[model samples]
Each structure stands twice: as structure tokens, then as C-alpha cells.
Target chain A: MSSSGITPITKSVTPIPASATVVEAARLIEAEQSTLPVVDEAGRVLGVVDSASLLKALVPRYLEQLSHTGFIRQDPAGLLRHALQAAQQPVCDVVQTLPEYLQEGASEAHAAELFLHTGVLAIPVVDADGGLVGVVRRVDLVVALATD
Target chain B: MAELLAVGVFVLAIALIATERLHRTVVALTGGAFVILIGLIEQEPAIAAVDWAVLGLLAGMMILVWGAQQTGIFTWLAVAVGRASGGRPAMLVLGLTGSTALLSAFLDNVTTVLLVVPVTLVLADTLDIDAAPLVVAEVIASNIGGAATLIGDPPNIIIGSAANLGFVDFLVHVGPPAVLGYAAAMTWLYVRHGRQLVPEKERLEALASLDPTAGLGPRRDVVIVLACTGLTILGFFVHGLFHLEPATVAMSGAALFLLVGRPDVETALEGIEWTTLFFFGGLFVMVGALEANGTLERVAEALRDVTGGNRTAEVLGIAWTAAIASGLVDNIPFTAAMVPVVRDLSAEGSDVTWWSLSLGACYGGNLTLIGASANLVAAGALNRANRPLSFVSFMKYGIPATMISMAIGSLWLLLLLAVE
Candidate 1:
């Protein structure tokens, strides 16, 4: 894939298992400061969970349908309790399924389209069997274009 | 013979739509193209067949509703109703479902339910009660409330435009039945689920602590949208007096909002349910072909023969048939096919067929999970909230609601016929 241009940094990111708790996934992201791919036992990617998805998980799921949240006010203690309860669910439940992903040997333009279309933090680069080859972070794609 | 072929294709499409084997829009569009492609009628007549006025009205209202929706006013109203209910189970149920009916009276039922169901699911969660009952009631109320006004439901819109009826016409003929049906539906709901809606004391306290106005958008946008909504409804009422169609009134409101609201033109236009409008377009062409071939007149004559040509029997028969057919299939296509037949059945210049069809079709939408778009939309919302309402489960409530509404509508039609 890099033959055409800069490719995903395979060594920089960490992968989280599909069965991991939302708390575990959040911690992994905090420690890595990168998007985490949720993978099954065979190392196939299910979807990616990132800070945005994690933030979504912390609130009531109904918030997804609501147009505004400015009115939702809770005491910190109560809100923390709610978030903790929310974080205990399996991370798979909150994973944002990647619709447009980069395949092995795909060009950088495909990567840019996924970023532009989904506005996702990262686009997973998968192999033929849907194994996680790597992810191209939004920053990496932008910087590659800027400096190319 | 080509008319028979056209009829066959249209029936096959409706069956496919009823089964949901394909997207209704796709099926409708295909059916339309097949009839014309095979020369069922010429291109010019097919173009003439599509009711551009009804499509215009639907599109305009969609933009207007979305503009108001952006103000977060519906959400705010729903929340405010919940807060005002004092978390009392009876009051809460009544308030939530009642507000849904009120909203459906002005906006289309789908938009009404889309806004109300989410708030209901959230409120149910906060109060720790089952949301299913509340949602079912709201959906049923949506159909009934939609029947009372010309702009409230698609079936009524098609009926009004086809028959040259107006907003005031529907309110005079169907509004009373709608109010009675709402009462009957609410009573049935209370009787069936009253014992189960009890929220925990602690949850009630938590709910009370939340502010109802918290979700409101900017004050300015809310005021403007509300004023426009009021004006749109007002325009619908008097448009006939000014020699205007309802479509013109709705489009004018939409244009005014676009000019003043300054919402992204793209976003505002995006709110239109293009698939539905297109589906109506295709269905209209197919129905027009049927009308051109006198298929609808045959249907009308056969229907009249069944009722022995008595005006009272004719009115009640059309009403009940429209209800059952609408319940079994999606109401839009059924109403589309029936409009011409209703026109044919109208004897000596009476408008009773129009009102009966409107009331029966709208009431019938409460009969099954597949009966109306609003019901299906609510089911999807509930399923998303992990509170799935199945087809059978819906019918347990739906059957009685339909029966009650139908009974009321039939009697009201009969009473009107007797009086006149």
C-alpha cells in the first residue's frame, strides 16, 4: 500500500478484543492516544472503538436519537455513577462499524474518501480474510497529503 | 386486454409491497414504468396522471416540519408534557400520548411519532417503566389525529386533493370521529395497561429534578417556527376562500421559512421524504391507467351492487372496506386505488364517500403493525431502545383500537347521512 504513498503505521496502534469492557477500551485508547480496532478471536476486525464512540457510550443510548442534549443536567456524582454503569457493558455493543475501509494495497485516495465520508478518527486497513492489517488515522492521511 | 395486464402488474406490485419483499418505492416505480413501457397508456397521460399537487403539499410540509424540528420545539414540548404530568402514571401516559395526537394533528404522523417516541423511550427509562404501552398508544393516536385534518395524513391528503375537498371540509366531517376515537383508544389503553405503568418512587423524584426546557433550541428560531406553523394551519383553513389549493398554502409557508429561517437550503430540502413522494408519483400513474380503462368504475359499480345502491349502505360499505383493506395493506396505495372508486360511487353529488373513506382509512391504520408508516417507525424506535414491540403484540392492542375507531367512524358517517 505504501508503494503509492505513506501507509498506516502498523506498530503505533493497539488492538482491543471484541469482548473487552468499554472501560478497558477507553483505558487502552487513553494510553495509546489512538483509535482501537475491535477484533474477534481469529483476529478479524469487527469495528473500531475510539474516543468519540467512547464518549457516546458514557451517556444513555437514547441520546443517539435525541437532537439536543443541552437540557440533560445531572449532578457529577450521579452522572459518574451513570457513566460507570454504562462503561461496564461489552465494547462490541458500542463499536462504530467501518463502512468504507482500506484493503491491502489500496491507494491513499480510498483512505481519504473514508475519512471524508464517515468523519471517523481512523479507517481500518484489512487483509483479504478481513484481518486487521492496520488503520490509517485521520491525522496521518491529512499530513501525508499536506507534505506530499 | 392491456388494461387487464396493467391491472395485473399493479396488483402484483401491491402484493409485493404488502409482503415487503422489495422497497415499496422500488416496486411502485417498477410497476409504473412497466405499464407505460408496455404501452398501457401514452407518456403524456401518465405524466398527467401523477398528482403533482399532492406531491407538492407533502414536500412543502416536510420542509416546514423539519424547520420546526430543528428548533427542538417538539422535543421541548414532549419533555414539558412529561414534567407537567408530575410522574403520575395516569397523567404521564395521557400526557405523552395526548401530546403525540396534538402534534400529529398539525404535522404528519411519521414526524410526530419520530419526535415523540424518542422522548417517550427516554422518559420511560428514567421512570423505570415499560415504554411499549406508551409507544403503542401514541402510534394509534397518531393515525386518528392525522385523520382529523387534511394535512395530518397522506391518505387524507390524497382524498382531499382527489375530491377537491379542503382543510375545513375534513374538520367538519372527520374531526368529531377522530376525537371520539382518541378517547376510546386512551380508555382502552388505560384499561389494558394501567396496572403496569407504575414507576418507582425514587425514579419519579429523579424525573422531577430534570428541567423540561433544557432541550429547547434558540428562542428566536422557536418563535419564528411556531408563528409560521400557526400561519400555515391558518392558511390551510382559508386557502379555499381565496381560491387556493392546500399545496400552494404549504409551499408558501415553506418558502417563507427558507427565506427567514436561513437554514442550510440543502439541509432544509433534505428533510423531504422523497421516496414517499416518488412512490405516490408512481402509484398515481398506475391508478390513472386503471381510471382511464374504467377499471375503477367497474369496481365502483360492483361495490354499489353489493350495497344494492342504497346511499346509506353504500357509505357504510365503502367505509368498512376501506378500513379493512387499509389495515391489511399500507394505507397510501390502498387510498390511491380507492379514490377513483369513491368518486364513482358518489351518487347525485354527495361528498359522503370522501369522508367515509378518509375516516375509515385513517382509523384502519391503527389496526396492525404494518397498517401505517407511523406504527412501523415507532416499532423501529422501540426496538432500538431494546423494547421491541412485535406484530402480534401490537395487534393485541391494535385490534381493539381499530375496532373502536371503526365503530365510531361508521356511526358518525351513518348519523351524518341520516341528518342530511
Candidate 2:
């Protein structure tokens, strides 16, 4: 069985637009799934956004400079205000542009390889033209392997 | 031809080390091997030149410090000082600087700074202040403090071993000047940067909330390590009376700790900085090659001509020249090269010039970020914590600190010479 057999790309899977705000993307991910594909106007897959990416986007840029040092707790009121301000940024600004994706015609073995290498729970499946096709999740790969 | 080749290689090694484009140990070891390969020095002499006392002292002290670190005693002591300051930023800085200087006088400056700077940074964060000034102050203080004792700085260790000076001799001669220089440096730091470290209300609250005693390790380990360190220091005092070397005292302490503490010997040994040990080994051989040839004698002759047998001129000249040279290069290698030259300048029993060289070389390290191993290690720790201390920024503080400290050192030396 190839990746096409395990892809969950029915008509209900709607890709988020690049122009959407981070809150909009987050709401969509919350409503549908943890992972959402970000597509440009021409239906080309631009990147992927997930709950983890959204949380990362809400963090102040300066905090990245604190390499290896653990996070310092801020006042809750200030942290909420900062996070709310970050929620208005464009999804494209916070999306993981280099996310791992699988081609629709790829095999289940290839899907397993990508999952192991990237350590991601789910990977977006794209067409040959790089259009959003579907997603292959870890659970889907596990079912496919079990049946094989 | 062999002498020329050896000198060329030595120069190249120093150039590489100054440029910092490569690791210093690699360059030093390569230069040492090249000198031997070209027949400037043979195998046995090179082996004999390694200064095993300095290496043994370094290794043993490293083991002792490493074991003590596992007990978290250094952090506890620093935090206790911070608490005593009552969250006042200036007092905290003064206390930390003073503590670092005192600890550095007995310990390796690099290890002393390594243990102290991190705690200082945490304290600075609690105070919600920039740590750059405080960290830089500690770096300078550590170098100065190390100058006061025979085993404090590597150059002092080399000087003590080479000149056969005892621990008490260094304490009596160099200790007073080091204390005066420390006072001058701390005064300058407060005058220049004290106002910038004022703690905000929220920062003061945060500082008050910190539990200084929370991180102190097991009580048994603390007691054992503290006892070991105390006895080791005491041993340094009486080692001369017993006709024992400092290395013997240090290694015995280290061995006793290892036996009692029962820390994994393999893991504890791994903490020893073998690279630094090897660097010392290689540098000694390279300097040995220079001595094997007549190159050191030529340098000495040139210096003698310049001084014209004027004792005052010779004393001041050696001190100031060493300060400037140490600022530009690693003081260890500079001290290594100057040791022979200083010997040639003075008679066997006269140790005035040796003290001058030690004071200048030790204090000269405060001139630049790259001047000493301690400064570089502190800077590296700062960089790792994402508080990047730029070289130019450090020089703004370093240049004045060096000038004031070196001036005090010179005056002290001159006064000592006059009295004698």
C-alpha cells in the first residue's frame, strides 16, 4: 500500500490560507486537527502550521537569544497581553516554512521514513504540482503497518 | 640553521595563538613537535622541560575543585554573599568582586571565574540588571587576585617553580600589591558603573524571593569537600617546613577527597581540562628550544644594554614591558619566555626582578579580553548564556583597569626596591 491509501484527504480537509492571521490558523487547527496545511492563492502548499508552531510564534523574539538557558517566568498579565498581540500576526510570518511533506504517490515505507527522520506527528501530503493533497499521520502509518 | 627554524616556528605559534583562528593547544603542540623534529632540542631534554610540578599542581587542583563543585559549595558561598548585601546592586557587585578575588588567590583563576560568574549572572538577573559590568569586574579581579599567591595563576606557578620561591615568599612580596590593586580596581568600577546597576522595585522583590540555601548539595558532601579544601590550603602554608612541594600537598588533598567522596573516579577525572595541561606541556618545550639556542641570552643582553645596570631602570622596565607584552599575548607564554631573561638580568639570590615580572604579567591580563585564560573563560561563559560581551565593550573597562592596576604595581615594586 502506498501513501495514497492512508492519506486522510477527503473533501472536508480545508487548507488554511497564507493571508490568515495566527489566531485564525490556530482556531482552524483547534477545530479540525493539530496540523493544518498553509496554501497560497494559487492552491500551492506554502508551509504547515500546528499548535506547537503557534505557541512558538507567541514567544518574544528576544527569548530565542537566551540559548540553552531555561525560560524565565513573566507576569501572567504581561504574558497574556504579549501573546494576544502576537496572535494578530500573519500566519505566513509564523508558519514552519520548511515543514516535512510527502508526495501523494509515495509509499507507506517512505511515509514511515519521513516520520522517523523528521520526528513529526503528521506530515502534509502534496500533489506532484505541490498542491495540498492530504495528511499522513503517525496513527495512519501505524494502522497501515499493522495490516501489512 | 636549527636555531633559526626553532625561532620561526615559535613565532608562528605565538602569531596563531594571538589571531585565535585556531585552538591554542593545537598550535603550541605543533610548534613543540616541529622544534624537536628539526633537532633544536632532543627527546630527553624536552621531556625534562615539561615542568611536571606545574602540571601536577594544575591537575590535582582541578580534581579538588571538580569534587568541590559537585557539592555546590561555591554557589552557596556566592549566594550567601548576595543575601548579606540585602539586594543592593552596588554592594552585591563589591561583595562578588571581593569574593572572586579571594577565591582566585587560592584557586586557578579560570576555575574560580567559572564557578563565580554563573552565580553572579543569576544574581544580576534577580536584580534585573545588566551583568556585563559585574562579570567583567570579576574577570579582572580574578587575574589580580591570582597574582598574589604562588598557585593562584599559572604564571605564578611557573615562576614559583622556576625560581624555587615558596608559598609564603609570594604571599609576603606579591600579596600586598595585589590587595592595593584590587582596591583601586573596585573603586574604579564603582565610580564608573555603580549608578547603572540600581535595582528596580520588582527586581528587589524578585531578589528577596530567592532561596539562597535551596541549592546547597548534600550536607555530608559539603562538609567533606570544605574540610578537604581547608586542609589543602593549610598544607600549602607548611609544605616548605616539611620540605614538601606544593604539588605534593595538592595531590594528597585530591587523593584524600577521591577516597572519601567515592565519586566515580572516571567521571571526575574526565572533568580535568587535558587540553590546558597539554598546552602547558607544549609551551614549555617550545620555550626550552629557545633556551637551548642562545636566543634568550641575546634578548637578555639587549635588555641589559637598555637598562645599563641601573637597578631601578631594570625593575621598572621589566614590569612595564611585561605588562604591555602580556596585554598583547597570552601571559603564560610571555612569562615562560621572560623567565630566563629575568634570570639572566639578576644574580641568583636577588628576587626583586622576578617579583616585578610576576606582578606585571598577572595584572597585565586585565588589559584586554584575550590577555588571560580567565578572561576568555568568563567571556565564553557569558557568550554561552547569550549575553554577548563584545571585545570593544570589554576594552572600554579593561584599558583603565590595566593602567591603574599596573601603576600601583610599579609603585609598590619601586618602593620595595628603595627600601632594600
The model with the greatest DockQ is 1
Model 1 in CAPRI terms: which quality? acceptable
lDDT, residue B348, model 2: 54
Cα lDDT, all candidates = 0.85, 0.83
- The candidate scoring highest on TM-score is 1
Query: What are the per-residue Cα lDDT tens digits for candidate 2 across B5-89?
Result: 7788888888899999999999999888988887889989999988999999899999999888887677777767875787776
What is the model-wide C-alpha lDDT for candidate 2? Answer: 0.83
Please tell me which predicted candidate would have the highest lDDT against the true structure: 1
Interface RMSD of each: 3.9, 7.2
User: Would you list the clashing residue pairs of candidate 1?
Assistant: A71-B214
Cα miss at B285, model 2 (Å)? 1.1
Q: After superposing candidate 1, which stretches have Cα over 4 Å from the reference?
A: A1-4, A12-14, A54-61, A75-94, A99-110, A124-130, A133-135, A140-148
